[model samples]
Target: MIKATHRPKHSSIPLLALLLCGLGILALGTGAVRMSPAEVVQALLGPHDETQARILYELRLPRILVGALCGALFAASGAILQGVVRNPLASPDIVGVAAGAGLAAVVNLMLLPNTPAWLLPVGASAGALAAFGLVYVLARQSGEVLPIRLALIGVAVEASLDGLRRLILVRADDSIAQALIFLSGTVYGADWERLFRVLPFAAVLIPITLLLHRRLDVLSFGDETAKSLGMRLEPARLVALALAAGLAAVAVMGVGILGFVGLIAPHAARLLVGPRFGLLLPASMLLGALLVVAADALGRGLIPPIEIPAGLLTTLVGAPYFLYLMRKTGRVR
Candidate 1:
């Protein structure tokens, strides 16, 4: 009986590792022109035929890398926010963070036509900060912020900004098609340069999160308990929120709003690994990366010659799962 109990625990790590490797192989192999797993492995290791080399290096690698980064960032951000609020439903997308970044990018494209590509992410970060600031101010009461109120305020703000974005698109002189595609969240145009732009922020933020993992775990308890445990409640909350927001903003700026990834991935990881943030965060990142990569592969391969947006595929899969979770949690307000 003891051995049976230990067997599952002992096997989980290897199982997870195997799953990740399989997903990575599948991601590399299942793109537009299907490549065998052996071909994919060969392409990565050394020079292949010119066509295979170009496809592997120029096309698939960037998309896979960016997809992984975006997924991991979103999942980490979601894990942080959910921990902060102690609510399973609290994700960056649901809290106006992605909308804020999206609105900023849209405005920059429409109003500041001459702005450099690099500055677009800067604008996105600024907009995300502004939205969070607004939510913080509006949700504060007697020097304490309520999580539920913050979420509600975020929903309202996101709705308002989304309306404004549509209005801007309607009146703009240029084609709204590109903007629409972007808003749906895709890595179709991701290249090395854009990947490089997002990598630094992810590098910085993810490590900081790992360092603060213990504090996050503590904060998951009720506020009073966390304070009694020597956590400075407001300051810690603010710092976590900042990290989560920055991660979300950078992700949105890099590849429009990918919904449900942040929420679903973290929650799923929590179920698999338990509630300790130290384990949960990294697990969430890995699972999140896997999900997005797999979804991207599905989007590219589902129809011959035609592609669906990764965001749409995620929404179709994620929304129903989210609803099921909400029902299970009985936390609907």
Candidate 2:
């Protein structure tokens, strides 16, 4: 009985890891031109044939890696924020981080067309941090970050930032299509260059987030409890919020507004593995990665040559689930 009880607690990590590997393989193997699993492995491991090498290395591999990284970033960010605010609905996109990043990226594209592409991510991170800080300042009352207030203020801020994003996009005569496609959240043209662009930011943010699980757990137990246990509430919260904002910003800068992964991955991870942030963090990352890979694969396969964006697919799937979550939480009002 004791062993059985402990088994479920630890099983989720390995299971999620396995799921992520399978999804990664699936994402690589199935596209406009399908490769068998053997071909996928051979391409990954061995002497590179030109055709297989081009398909795997040039196109599919980078997209798959970027999808996985973006998913991990968003999921980890959401998990951190949800734990910090003690709200199931809190996510980067819902809370204005994505919108802020989007606004900054749009502005960057509009104003400095000649700027190195790398600076876009930096601008996005700055915007996301600024937006989150603004929301926190507006939402906090009596030194407490209340759930409803935060969510409402986040939505309001998101709406306002979204307007600015549109304003920038509208002024762009030459780059409008590019901006719209990006806003719709397509990893359509992802290549090694884009992969390298996002890798550094996500590479740094994700490991740091996983390391913060203990602090997140302490914060999740309410400010009074955290203080009683000698955890500094404000500083801890700041670090958690900053980590989340940066993670989400990097994801947005990479993938162009993945709306659902951040919100759904954490909830799904908690359901699968329980709310222990240590397990929860990694599990959420894997789950989010799997979600995006699967969505990308399905989107590519669903309509043949005309591919749907993974972001749009996720939104379609996530909206109803979001409603269900709200209903369950009894806070839809």
Candidate 3:
């Protein structure tokens, strides 16, 4: 645990929020028919130019919101899981949460092709919880979930789920292209529908996540210490797992398995804000939002005609960081 003395005061919180807003503005201005910040604000407030207003209101704003919210939710989910598992390495992607959601989504789309659009997020959330539940049950020994056990079990389960997902995708043939959107994690052609779909989940889960920070703090204190503090170990872990899975699933519903936002954002926030969950939760959210929005901006701006998937760019950065983390922690401290 990070000592209180090492925890910086709350000064960094506002700074990260400011940076996220600035990045959001810059991201809004990116892409063809680029507008300056002044123009972006003007378009947002009231459209002097019809085309500009349409683009801002219909296209860019919702895309940015989805991307930023997904990033924040993923970060929060990862933070919760890390505390639950008591390992820096635990995240939605790494711990079978994303894979579980992906598999459920694939099954929903491929098998039940005409599945109601409204059921997609629900299916994803259920899948995420089921996968983590499998991991939890398998990883526990003598009613305790050790960090090493959970990480190892998670890796095994993630691999199995991803492998199954790939096989189904290959068989789907015509659906392969469409599946890539969720599998590869792109926000391209994002619209108001997705933003609206995601908003209620965000409104509910994000606050619940913040409220659970103290619970997370307790979970991180190890089984014995946490028990001494009146925390009921098993039930608490189950609730936290469900919350984390829901956050990650809802996030990927729009963005499709964004790599490492879950892992990297919380870790970076931990460096700045210390291991305290209360401060760590919000800081991770802001940094995660900034990361996705910035990555989306760069991806869009890097090439005019072709849009790189935000997941690809994040993976490019996150994969190396993941390696460094593994090396530094030797399967996490």
Candidate 4:
């Protein structure tokens, strides 16, 4: 028993890292042209064929990097939200968070075609913050946060928001092609500029998340227990929720709403490494990155000169897992 338990704990982090590295290499090498791994490595190291070099530098590298970053952020945000809400179903995608971002993004794209590119992310961030505050307010009762009530409220809000989004999409005069793709979430057109835009936020937020890991662990242990342990319940919850919303918003802006990675990765990591927040967070981030990179690579390679959306693949993969988790919990109600 001890060996079995110890083995996973020891192997989880390294295994996740190795998987991420392998996926990164595969994503770089396997596309329409199909460069060998050696060529991919050479291109990354320096210059190879100028044409291939441009493809790698300008196109594939950024998509892979942004996919990895967005995956990590989403997964980390899910883990944090799950811990705080004490509900496995409490992912940003499941709740109203992604819908909030999507609503703003879609509205902006439809109404303000000429809006500065940079402002898209800003709008997304604002929408996310607003949604987070709305959920928290609805979830609070007499200075106490109730997990089940919060989750139910979130589900209702999400359904309503999703309905609104669909209605907007249906009535709009513009072509729905771009709106559909963005709703499905793909990293296809990501470039170095987009990567650079989100990097600073990811760099800043990930470290803060790491630092707050301990506090999150405490928060997971019920409100009364956390209070007994000297945690400022409301303030800590607000801060964590805000950070998570910002992370989720930035990711959606960067790569559209790639769902499932956030919900699936953290749960898988928890199963592998146990529920210790410290190990869980980093392991989930790496595994999440790996999943998106692999999915993106598969999307490109699955069809010749045609690709599926990475978000669609993630949803296909995630839905079964979500169902299984619900069953494990013995009904979502």
Number of the top candidate by TM-score? 3
Candidate 3: pairs in clash: none
> Residues 186-277, candidate 3, lDDT per residue (tens digit)?
77877889888888989999898888888888888888888999998888877887788788888877687889999999988988988888
Which one wins by TM-score: 2 or 3?
3
Query: Which 10 successive residues of model 1 have the least lDDT summed?
Result: 1-10
Instruction: Indicate the worst ten consecutive residues by lDDT in candidate 2.
Output: 1-10
Ranking by lDDT: 3, 2, 4, 1
| Residue 7, model 1: Cα distance from true site in angstroms | 13
- Model 2, residue 205: displacement in angstroms? 1.9
Between candidates 2 and 4, which one is better according to TM-score? 4
Question: Any residue pairs clashing in model 2, and if so which?
Answer: none
Q: Is candidate 2 or candidate 3 better by lDDT?
A: 3
Q: Any idea how many clashes model 4 has?
A: 0
* Per-residue lDDT of model 4, residues 196-270, tens digit only: 889999999999999998899888888988889899898898778777777787788788788788899888888
Judge candidate 3 against the unseen true structure and give its global Cα lDDT, from 0 to 1.
0.83
Candidate 4 regions with alpha-carbon error over 4 angstroms: 1-11, 176-180, 331-333
lDDT of 1 by residue, 223-297 (tens): 888889888888788788878888888787677788799999999987877777878888888877888888888
Model 3 alpha-carbon drift over 4 Å, by segment: 115-122, 331-333
Going through the candidates in the order shown, the clash numbers are 0, 0, 0, 0
In model 1, the Cα lDDT at residue 31 comes to: 66
Number of the predicted model whose lDDT against the real structure is largest:
3
